[model samples]
Target: MRVVKAPDVRRSEILAAANQLFQTQGYSRTSVDQIVNKVRIAKGTFYHYFKSKEQILDALADQLVLDMAYHSEQIANHTQLNAIEKIVTIISEQNRLQSEQQNVVDSMHLPDNRQLHERINIKIVLTFGPILATVIEQGNQQGLFDVKDPLSTIQFILAGSLFLFGEGVFNWPPEQAQARIQSMIILIERTFGAQPGSMIIALNQCLNEEKR
Candidate 1:
């Protein structure tokens, strides 16, 4: 008798294989054949789950956003950490995730990856905004932040930063990127009514940790 996997489990296996290939081989170079071979699945089976390689990529992006939101929620709900600390923790988690997936992250900057990159950014904001907004809302209740609309504030923040780092959008030089990042820190601080330099310090620390 042959053991059978559930549809969701099989889909996840396909995605896992695709993710590993995309990481090691780069998205453009990783074909559906490679993914199906990795999973020991037939071509028809692969198509049963995903219409095309691009569909798999989109699913991967959705998975990334969901994972990020899950991690953010964990940090946001840590009872011992204050509102500011929770925000910092969430940022640190983001940096850590990016670092771990650096290769995949770098691929998103390729010229051909523009459309997928935009879709990922939109998914990230849609998924992560509410998680961050919960932290911001808690901060407001604690008098640690003053944002009038937590969800909208978080959404704007994500969109602005995404636009800055977007591959084809700004094409910012190192100096320009640094300047924009600093400005973003200031904007976030003011938006949250946090101390003038607090977010800068926290963000710098997170960046330093990412480098390690």
Candidate 2:
């Protein structure tokens, strides 16, 4: 018997199956047939939800950004933390999640996945920019920041960070990458007129905890 499911439920299953295949076998190696087989769905059913494998990848990217945005928003709205603390906590949580899903990250960096990879970066900028900007705005109002335009400033910062750290785009040596990370911390502090080392100390403390 053909099992029927809601459109959204079926689509989620397709994406979930595709994500697993992509993680284990990589994007180029995983095809439409493999995804359909995993979900036990017909080719027509797959096509009904997604026009092409590329389109599916785009949807997956959007989902990834949405998940990240949800977590960041939760941190942004926390009454206990100030803006700086919110920023640090959000970043720390994101890094921890990414580290746990290293396979997904590695899959996105695979051959023929550049477009998918780039799409995710752009989506992150669009989705996360607004959320982080709200935090910055809160900081600005509290006299903890001096940003002239919260949205634009955060979008610029996010775009730069994504591209710079995006693995396939730039293969920086560990030392160079660390240097850039430190420089970025300083740049953010200066841009927001934060007291020197304030952001650095907080961010490093979070990062150190991750290492332990």
Candidate 3:
């Protein structure tokens, strides 16, 4: 009988190594040979787990979107915060996640895997819908926000916040990324028909001193 180890554990280890290597070098520069060598796995074993380097990078993107979902869920659980406060929380959380993903992307050429990138982008956008729905429901119930279509509104906000990252259209200074995100949050809040002053104040309080 063969002893069995958890597939996910081994896969997670492989992905961790890939992330590290891909960051230091780059995605395009990272070959499967190096990854298996670094992971101390045989070439056959590597194929057993992943079909190609693109698959691995796709896995990386999927992991990030899952992480974003996890973090946003955590923020949603902070019921102590009000609806507006939750918007701020959501903004900071997504921006924080984007920065980390960008660092990983910087070390890799993920755009070459355009399909995977688009899939992961959809994953992130889909993950955000629930939280926004909750906020929209709460705000409308409280008469603090007006919305005709919660789903469409959520989609718009998600697109506005993350469109640039998905398309690689915008890049901001490291010191200013948070600020730019906050600015987008302000735009989203206003577009959703929330009072900018209270929402902005709430968002500013959520950001670190440096970001504010």
Candidate 4:
């Protein structure tokens, strides 16, 4: 008897196969046939779910962004956490996800993948901006943050961080990079009207926990 998988399950299988191939063989060299073969699926089956190889790449990026957004939204909705705690939780989860996907991140940074890299960055901002904005707005209402526009502020922070910290955008020496990161953190605190060291301290604790 032939087995028929559910649509979502089958699509996930295809994506998992493509992700592995992309990681091991590089996206530029991975073909649709390779992905289908890896998943033991027909070319028609792959095309049924995704229009093109580029779309598969986009789907992969969507999955990553959605995963991060889900985590952020969950934290944002938690009634027990204040705005600062929510922000710290969201960042910590985002960092953990990014670190887990570091290889994929590095692959996207390759010069040939610049277009896809840019698309992924935009997707992140679009998906996460609103989720983050709500948290910031909550902060504003609670007097934890003073922002005229929460969504705009979040988008700006996301875009600037992506640009400044994106791989190959700038190559700074170790000390310079550290200084710039410090400056960015301080700027973020000021932007939110947060206490001078509160965000810095919270972020440092988050990072230290990640390291452990």
Per-prediction TM-score: 0.89, 0.87, 0.77, 0.85
The predictions' CA RMSDs to the true structure, in order, are 2.3, 2.6, 4.1, 2.9
Model 1, 24-77: lDDT tens digits are 878889988899889997898989989998788778776766777889999988
What is the overall TM-score of model 4 with all chains considered together? 0.85
User: What lDDT tens digits, residue by residue, belong to model 2 across residues 1-212?
Assistant: 99999999999999999888877777778899999999999999999999998787777766766777889999999999999999999988887766655556666676677878887888888888999999999999988999999999999998998888777778778778777777888899999988888899887666444433
Candidate 2, lDDT over the whole model:
0.84
Q: Positional deviation of 80 in candidate 2, in angstroms? A: 0.6
RMSD of 2: 2.6
Q: Kindly list the per-residue Cα lDDT of model 3 for residues 1-212, writing each as its tens digit.
A: 54355888778878888887777787767888899889887788778899988778778877777777788777767768777766677777766775766646543334566666556657666777876787777777777787778777888766765555333456556556766757766776776788766666655655443232
Candidate 3 backbone clash number: 2
TM-score for candidate 1: 0.89
Candidate 4: minimum summed lDDT over ten consecutive residues — where? 203-212
Which residue window of length 10 is worst by lDDT in model 2?
203-212
Candidate 1, superposed: residue stretches over 4 Å from native = 1-3, 207-212
RMSD of 3: 4.1
Predictions in order: lDDT: 0.81, 0.84, 0.70, 0.84
Could you tell me which residue pairs clash in candidate 4?
Answer: none
Ranking by TM-score: 1, 2, 4, 3
Error of 1 at 35 (Å): 1.6
Residue 144 shift from truth in candidate 1, angstroms: 2.0
